[model samples]
Target: TYTTLDIQNLLAGGAGNPIGHLATPAASRAPGEDEILGRVTLKYEPTDRLTMTLKASYDRNSVNNSSWNYVAFRCGLGSGISQLSGYACDNDKFVTHQNNMPADIAANFPYAKKDGQLYNRYESYAINGNVNYELDNITISSVTNFNRNNNRWTCACDFQSSNNATWATENSTWRSFSQEVRALTSFDAPINLMVGALYQKTRRNFGQWVAFAGLRNSAASPENQFVATSKTSFTKGETTALFGQVTWKIVPTVELAGGVRYTHETKDSFFTQPYNNPGVTGIFRDQNDPDGLGVVNANQTFNNWSPEVTLTWKPSRELLVYGAFKTAYKSGGFSNGGINSKFSTNPLADLTFDPERARGFEAGIKSTLADNQLRLNLTAFTYKYLDLQVDFFNSPIFAFQTLTADAKTRGIEAEFEYAPRAVAGLNVHGSLNYTKATYTKFPLAPCYAGQTPAQGCAAISAIDSRQNLNGAPLSVAPRWTGNFGVAYDTDLSSTLKLGTNVDVRYSGSYLASGFNNPLSRQSKYATLDAGVRVGAWDDNWVIALIGKNLTNRLYVSGVVDGPSTGSGTGTAAGIPADQLGFANLPRTVQIQLTKRF
Candidate 1:
């Protein structure tokens, strides 16, 4: 697959430049990918009450692209015109450009590099086996799975330089094994029960290397080129769990079900980084540790219990209502970098984050009306989260950090499908959702840069404290979302058929940061998609012409607040005030052919 990207504001003149935009057709950004997948399955039944199955699959994917973000240089340009004077702009900002172009006024203007060059390759394979036995009203099953993956990635940190650009490479290997056993019982009475036990183990090895051209050139010899930094890490984890569920038919039209699961997990990790030069440090490290002896070795264990209860009522043959309450939790883990690297001496304590827990309640109804021609479903839910984990990039330190906070979310979802009995192969469907999510209790949260005490920043807080986000809306949580679509199909001939579909999707504006900065919010936007399909040979083979985002709507898919280029100081540290991230993909059209065997 190949696709082009549009980096907004890659040029100094935004969209009014006469020389042409940065992402013009002649200089459009393109990314390419190739993937291959294979799978096989086998099933056997040796007896009336016994069955066995085996499955295996493999996948490999390779991706190559330019920079993910077109970071602009902060050079001061007197006018947005072409000039060749090297002294026309401040050298401090002009030098930030990675390309080899001369530091002329024209070159100083923000221009997105056409080639930054990043490549990634991933390969994985898995095998699974299942066995089942049944006797009378009881059934037993067992499953086993093993998987392994290898990943490699390389990228140029600086795009402008031909042979002197900064670059990084990472390699990772992961392996996992899992087993599960379960038993189910169904009695003559109105009751059913199931119990299961599961165990899993995983291991990972990762390493990264970074180098700079300037440092390499400064080396004593070409054979001893500089190696700014290198990192090596290893992790191992194991988990054991037991779960059970029971359902009882309390009455002719009512049923109640309950389930519980308990899990115990253990994890161990080791990390170390070596600085090749005594004066040089890793991007995530703020101190100069010449010995490169900074190491993180830690082990931790956790145990959790989750439970759920549900009540269902079938008021009639065509109508059903249900309510449920559940409690869930996610395992805690150690941070990979950021603040954790800064506190290398006690990484276990400073870089570790607690598990996330949540309690939720939901009620929903499902109904079929108009002689089964229409189906509708509606649901409302609310949840309270404790220690919700969040990840943010720390511009001040030029690293990423993981944090936890408490939050609450309430939402409603509705969906409907209509197919008039009078018209065959004609159907309409749609769905709508509304979400209200906010931080219920959060202290010591980082405030947006430039935010004052009166504007929600804490007057006096902890070392890293910024704003009090107790009531701020959750990041990426849009309030309103909806989708509508219609499809029609008809017989074109005895063995041929034609089908067409159209869909519209819309989303409301919402904040993109925990600090609720207005600048980080993305306004509402909508897109339309359409497709036509032609089938032959009793629909065994089909071809489709599909068009997505037909309107060519320009919008941001996501945002991360920060400076467009180099890190800033003071209140400008890390905030979405600067729109410098990758833009969403433009309109796409494709033709697809599928066959069934």
Candidate 2:
């Protein structure tokens, strides 16, 4: 194993971008993932005018994942902070003089370690059925759907890589069912009418156990290796909606339509954490602890009336134009996620936020030219969002929380397709997108670990904090994105065909954090992919070879501050917290086969 300083120096002066170049083997490198998926569909017709269809699917996944350890150094400016709480520094600017080790190394380089892997299992089952009956002037239809999901995963909180041994696990389950009925008119008049009504209900539950680190490894002493928390939450939701639309055919080539939907929704939420145990974990803790004193029960109701209007005109058989305006809202819900403590004020009032709403407009044009060999489409859109749900880092709690922010987004998208008549086997397509997404008002955002007073860090309370991120861009909302692809197809035989394609995808730089963590910013990146396939004319069987990220670009996808010391506070905030990021998958090539009946 390489020493701490050795790896530190190699990680670009302790910045640690692109750590894959290091030759050191990982401390732990085993991850397991298994999945099963199946789907089936059936169709029946009793008469030409009546038809029915049913579809069902099931998916199950089991994953055993782990996190590797990383060394940390105490910062020179971090004079009064504790050793393991919300503190980690290894960058050159923050490392203290390493008088505790050989060669006057600045900062202590404690070797990182991990206890075990994280276990997660998920399963989902779904069923859908539809029936349509056609009459003289109107058609009637009904649709029904049901879904169930079960999941359990280890929580990725209390992350510390330097001797901060902790682990947490959560169990969750969800189920929902919905039914909708609709009627449509097909009269010979210049106008058509359609209407539908829907009803749905959902239920979900989650429970978690947090094992905080203690001085001893034994569970014999009730307080040692204590289970910091044993909490559970339950949520139930119901929705009823009625929607209708009317279309007016102004002419053979023009049409105008309007639609409106009214929805009533309700949420029943409950959360609790037991205080009946001596805070012990595993075999020593009581799962049936009677602690009604710590429970929080909450309920919420919402009503929304969404409306939209659209106009479409076809100037010719080869060209079309369309424009639309719409307003919609998302339902509000309680935030009984994790554990809630009575000491933390009213849990419902503090965590629950209003429903997000949006009003937007869009316009588009589509054209086909060059004797139908060339096609182009362009669209532009803008939306004003209020009370957008935002998950942000909280330095005091060392965990992220859900809040609300006001935001806006505007964008333009263009796509083109070309199929040269001269090149009978070749086709080309590409798209370009530009977006601007920013928070208009977010005064209560959390600051990065070490933001100073001058940078807008302040105390909401003795144990809470806030920072102004009034104009920050939305997380993961890149300003620009584009893709280009080319494909060729040829007949190998009367019964067989060959196809090949190549594509390149690109994205502009963007911050990966809602709070705008400097270390979590991602620069622009692009990837190339290619595939080749051979298949029968009927598509009864096929074989293909595909390669992804052929350029092997190791771009960061997302970031989370963890391993133990989550978001740093106090003296630890003076230095940027130890950042943890996830990278895109490496380059790989695989062969796939498919057969259909």
Candidate 3:
């Protein structure tokens, strides 16, 4: 017996007349988001060993945005806001001099229109316990868990006419508590063992006015026709972790598993001061405790290790096979608190950077066919990396180097299932995958153009180590993906009941570079989904008709760099390319109802 209840609401909309992205100027300033979700689960067992479970959850999300917009290269022209209206001198950093309009409309178009309001709240509570013990040859088992989580976020923004006008108003509160302890052992000979350990911790707080700003750009510019002012920043960090695992059965079809884990981490940041422009000097200093950053001591510590191994084979029992080796690590960070960096008086050395690595290998197969109505599984993998911490554009770069431009990934995964229970209740499932990532050696950073006789004021550096990135592919990793499903149940004779389902997914073409800059590409798309169900009496109803991107294909996920290098390359066009995507959710229809006690 099973009981469940769920309620979901989501609304997203976009209606013409809003376009801006000549390299991500907040992408026309977001506006549309409303979400709500509720769920419940319960299970019970009367005797023989004891089992009970209960879970509850709720979430609410809201957003109506517009933080900053005014393209055309903040007013210099490289085609953004799609050039807003008119200004094209054959593009690519135009040059034909004066009275040509496209210089941010002669400098007074100083735009900053971002209206925002946000609310987020989530709640969850869970309890689960299980026990079974019998000692004859040795059989003992126990499982226990408890969970509680609560989160909150509030926001307000407006940055129109400079007193900085509130732009970011904030509040954040989070609480999490969890516990898990388990033990189990059973042996008859042929070598057998099981052992486990796990622990966790979480704490967070941002009381109120945590810190906020919607969008900004203004180091004060209006010369050679380039005016600027756009800013949007928000910060919060708090975390903790603990983990462990093991299993072995040396013989009886060979089964072995091993695991190791160790982790400890902490981070803190709070900032709000420096709305610059009256007399700028050294990182725009103007403070009175917008979370204080001058001598307010901050701390960071991290240690991480994860190791895993598994090998299993069983010639029979429906044919099974497995192989795996794993090691993963990601930790090391700090930066993003603002203020201090006219070139640093040292705000912790303007925030530090380092930490990123992964090593993995896997192989797999599981099968059952024809005789039992078909079922299959397959897997293949490869990963080796190091120090690859990249976030470029939001500022953070270690520059893709496994050692000297090393990052090779391989993948192949497949799954299939078909059930023909004489057609009484039909079912079919499917999955397919193929992944590829490349970059054998990438390093070549150099810039600085025009007016060079003694090279003193124009400079850009980091020249050569080796580069070969085969021109884009591996920005969200999607070299081809697939999924399919269909299910049916017929029985409208007693108590009236009928159920139906359908699902399909396909993805190919992915490159949303976080900055390796290979002509900036993000193109590839495919999607399909559907569902229907109905039940009477005890009450369970669902009338669903859902469709998304039923082939409304138009791609561009993200791209960057169009300026900001030495800022003058025959006209400057080396570090500016912007396009961010996943913008698909064009069709929708829904109806659902469920109840049980």
Better of 2 and 3 by TM-score: 2
For model 1, residues 142-230, the per-residue Cα lDDT tens digits are 99999999987655444322333345566789999999999999788789999999999999887766544334323323322334456
Against the true structure, what is each candidate's TM-score?
0.82, 0.82, 0.26
Q: In model 1, what are the clashing residue pairs, if there are any? A: 98-160, 98-161, 99-160, 447-466, 447-467, 561-575, 561-576, 562-575
CA lDDT of each prediction against the hidden true structure = 0.65, 0.67, 0.44
**Model 2, span 1-597: residue lDDT tens:** 111222233334322222121111222332356889999999999999999999999999876533322223232234534334444444212121110111111011111112333546789999999999999999999999999999876532433333233445667889999999999999999999999999999999876655433312233234322334566788899999999999999998999999999999999888766522242222122334333335567788899999999999998989999999988798788765643533333445644557989989999999998999999999999998988987654434332356889899999999999999898889999999999999999987876665556556676777665688888898889999999999999889999999999999999988866777766666788999999999998889999999999987755556555433333343324544445555555577889999998
Give stretches of model 3 more than 4 Å off. 1-249, 265-279, 286-292, 302-311, 314-320, 323-329, 336-363, 366-475, 479-507, 511-521, 524-558, 561-597
- lDDT value for model 1: 0.65
Ten residues in a row with the worst lDDT in model 3?
A: 1-10
Local accuracy of candidate 3 as per-residue lDDT tens digits, 1-597: 000000000001211111121211222223345667666767676664555656565655544332221112222233433211233322122121111112222233222122223333444554545445445544444445454554443222221121112222223344444444444445556554444444444444432221111111333343211211122223233334444455676777878877676666665544333243222222233343243443323466667777788888887878889888888877665433333323234455345555666788888888897788889899999886665554332111211121223466889999898887788678889899998876544443221222121322222323212123433344667788888888887778678667686777777866555434433344455566666677773455544454444454444344333222112322223223222232333445556666555
Q: lDDT for model 3, on a 0 to 1 scale?
A: 0.44
For model 2, state the Cα shift of residue 348 in Å.
Answer: 1.6
